[model samples]
Target: MKRIFTGGTILTMAENKQVEAVYVEDNVIKAVGTLAECREAAGSGYQTVDLNGRCMMPGFVDTHTHPMMLGMCRIWADLDYPKVAGIDDLIRVLKEHGKTLPAGEAIRGYAFDQRNFKERRHPTAADLDQVSTDVYVQIMHASGHCNVVNTKLLRAIGVTDETPDPPGGALGRDKDGKPNGQLFDSANDLLSGLDGVQPQNHGPNIHMPDSPDHLMQRFEVGQDFFVRAGITTVNEVQLTKQELNTYLRARDQGKLKMRMEMSFLSNYLDDVIALGFNSTFGDNWLTIGSIKFYSDASLLSGTANVSTGYLDSDRHEGYNYHEPEEMIEILVKAHKNRLHTLTHATGDGAVDPIIDAIEKAQAEDPWPEAIHRVEHAGLVTEEQAIRMGKLGMIPSTQPEFLYLYGDGVVDAIGEEKGREFMPMARFKKYCSLYTISSDAPVTTPNPMEAISTAVTRRTNEGTVLCPEQAITVEDGLKAYTIYAARTLRRSHIAGSIEVGKLADFAILSESPLDLKEDEIQRMRDIKVMETWLDGEKIYEKK
Candidate 1:
């Protein structure tokens, strides 16, 4: 049966087109034009849905996220800035959560940004010990580049004073040189590789796995979380083999609803090459994505390879996860195989080398369509932006970072250098190939909030970080809708509403363009009326 959806303002988001009605058949859009045209297109026996003057547009495509991590966050303790005040508050929350779990089970918490705490320091093992000495405890930083473990967790993971830090990573040390239970970068693998936990070589947030029977429950919760926020597609930025298999298992069981694109860790390059799998390898529900290579840790964690030293410490020039030559070698191999790649380059120092490596790979292999990208592209300078534009480099950025942590960024690097933090407007001037994302588990997946931040350049405290870098609301929306699909190489099938395209859309309570510019942040208050995927309404506001 066909369906004719009318009585709403439909923004096709394709070539800046608008229509009054849309006709959908099966799972694809049949036609989009005026009400009479749509009704004419849809013959008898067709269903009709009156939107009652609502606003409808393409569903959001969050170019970077981790569903498994989001699921883990749902099960774990919430340490987001709003929930905890200081170290004592953190301990109190953990203590209360620990009591509800089975004895000896590890208690995992996530999104704990020390910058938000009154102490202004990461909670040490001693701090976590205040929560529990009998049960193991692990708390991950909001950046997803670091983790903190209690004494019991350290012992459970077999890290001791004698344990040497992993290469290019660090285990926090006490004044007496004893391990202090904070893990950074690759050191996170110590916990991720533990029994019953998901494994990762590139990022943080390790937690116990869900039973096969229970996986769907947690997964549905995560899906609802995304759909409620108006996200229709997600790029699983970094996933280990086990996590990937879990998603595959869910798909086989017919549990997948949202479109999920995947990228493997760089360490898995060997497997990817052996399997002859490049990006975009599967059906719509699940598919291969870029190969993620972390050039450095996140900026807020103070481990990014920044050329300028941190303002707080003259000696703190951030470190890279791989040597220049090593990273280039990996890029060469992947590019030679014609695989798309997204390097996590957050600092000026990190950005240049990764770009150089990609340029070199393209020079040797000559695959212009691969669409190589830089994740974060956090501190790209003017010259680098021009070079990136010439090379057709796509920047997958998280604008919400500026809104949530802009103040800290200004503090890390002085205000002068800080202005370079995610210069979106500059990137648009130099290169038009950029997409915005939530990078959820680091921040909430709210497209409205992201768009608001991008357009206003204002932090949560209403401090304008760099108003010169602001973009228009329309540009911000395209970054999450059309351009985002372009980044994932799926623009043909998804991204917008057009003839023969997938009928995936979000119905809103009001039109964003109709609101005042000052009301951008309040766009978060706009209710999501319904979320439709493949012509089926998956979510509706009660």
Candidate 2:
């Protein structure tokens, strides 16, 4: 039972993008209107807290995210690719950052785009080893499907030319069939066995620190980071069995603080089916969300399986990680098991087949409220967008990506198709558009930043990648809040500030939708005066 959140301009995001302060009780928003109305409704028994005329809104729900990757903030090396001018610049960055770590320790970095670099090629192990033969290092390409490691690092991890490649992953090799120290999705097996990668100080596994009492510690810290950015929930994509078990153990212990709709990796379909679980199969804080399958390489890593070629180079054509038939098979299996299926679909070319596959599976056995998702449905055809809406599929997109990668899209997908980047308006006209967070160690989990970007559709100076696609600030706000909740099928309880909805909201310095776009960006690091999850104050900015 709580009292009052008064004197703040609240963005309810319910029906209209209404503004008001609210009163709460029994862990739900009891009333919303002017401050006097809430205070009067609350009475003397209510615990009163004034917001001093700031913004109070439903916490943002990021539909796509990976919180564990936050450890990368402390552990891995980031190549800073988007900022680099050329290959020589990347080499310089590696040489500088490699000097401060343990001698044999590897350098790992993320967020590099081949389109922006002069070399237009990822740096391999030899490139890294040349600077420091003693150190082992790996740089994950922006695509997230692959990364390149140095010889020292790969050898130390025991990846050799003779080692057979792991399923669903690739070990990039060079002249004469020698491993070139580049690994794609298959890198999981290659890195998992290496205790060195998890961090020796934490435990046998060097990458995942062992000192935390439970995984919830990681979740909470990650949640705070998200709240500060105004993100209320996240669709944490791709969980393995062990990872799912960890989340369960943490939740049972009451460690998870934010709302999470976690997805299952397609590889584990058989195991999940044997257990008899399907999509939207759990409670408020945790649940068995969509099942994940890959359609294309990550957009940042420069492979999106498009019919067109990359603007940077002729050889660098886009590609899909999974075969069309195999993808259809996954959808069929998931549909049969009654689990909702969501895949990573990004290219215009991939759109037709991906949708066709979904249609094929559904045509035989329809999922009555399937609530399927297409991750990064960035460059979809007009017909495909319409079909998605008609068929009840959700386009789980990253608005933040449009803000960050708009320029890169032009270089990576060519001008003709590049203009198709996150054309949300057209999609909204034809499909059910949804927004969620894809976060660290991917993109940041900040909803305010996401809100600003979504509305502005900001790109590199002098270049508006798709200005016509820009959404209203109010719509952008909902994309992260209510729209996000709907994507997770959690709208019944969370999403907006209304009776019976959980009292989960963030206190901000000012209303984001009211402030000028430029001011909104400068409002970075704004404090959350308080955060309530289940009618309880779990976090209050110190």
Clashes of each: 0, 25
How far off is residue 191 in model 1, in Å? Answer: 1.0
Candidate 1 local lDDT, 1-542, one digit each (tens)? 59988887887778746788999998899988888988888877889988898989888898888777777777789888879879988998998898889988888798888777887777899999998898889888888778899898898889977998776677888878888998988788777555544333344434445576566565666677788877888888786765677788887887777888888878778888898787648887888856888887778877787787787533278788788888888888888887888888888898887788878988877986887889998888889999999898888999889888888888888888886578999778877678999887678788888888888888887788778888888888889899998888878778888898888898989777777976777876777789998889988999
Per-model TM-score on C-alpha atoms: 0.96, 0.87
Q: What does candidate 2's lDDT look like per residue over 1-542, in tens digits?
A: 65787766777878645645678987778887776877787777887767788777887787777666554443445655455656667667777777777676556666666666777666677777766776666676655666777787788778887976654455677757778887765454466664313211111111333344435555555555665555656676767544566678777877667777778777667878988787747887788856877776556665566777666643366666566777777777788778877787777766766687778878998777777778888887778888888887788777667766787777677787786688777666776656645545556666666656656676644366666776776777777778878878888887888767888887777776666756655433455666667767666766
Question: Least lDDT summed over 10 consecutive residues: which range in candidate 1?
Answer: 198-207
Candidate 2, residue 347: how far the Cα is off, in Å: 1.7
lDDT of 1 at 204: 42
Model 2 earns a TM-score of 0.87
What lDDT does model 1 reach?
A: 0.81
TM-score of 1: 0.96
Model 2 residue runs over 4 Å out of place are: 34-41, 81-104, 156-178, 194-221, 515-530, 537-542
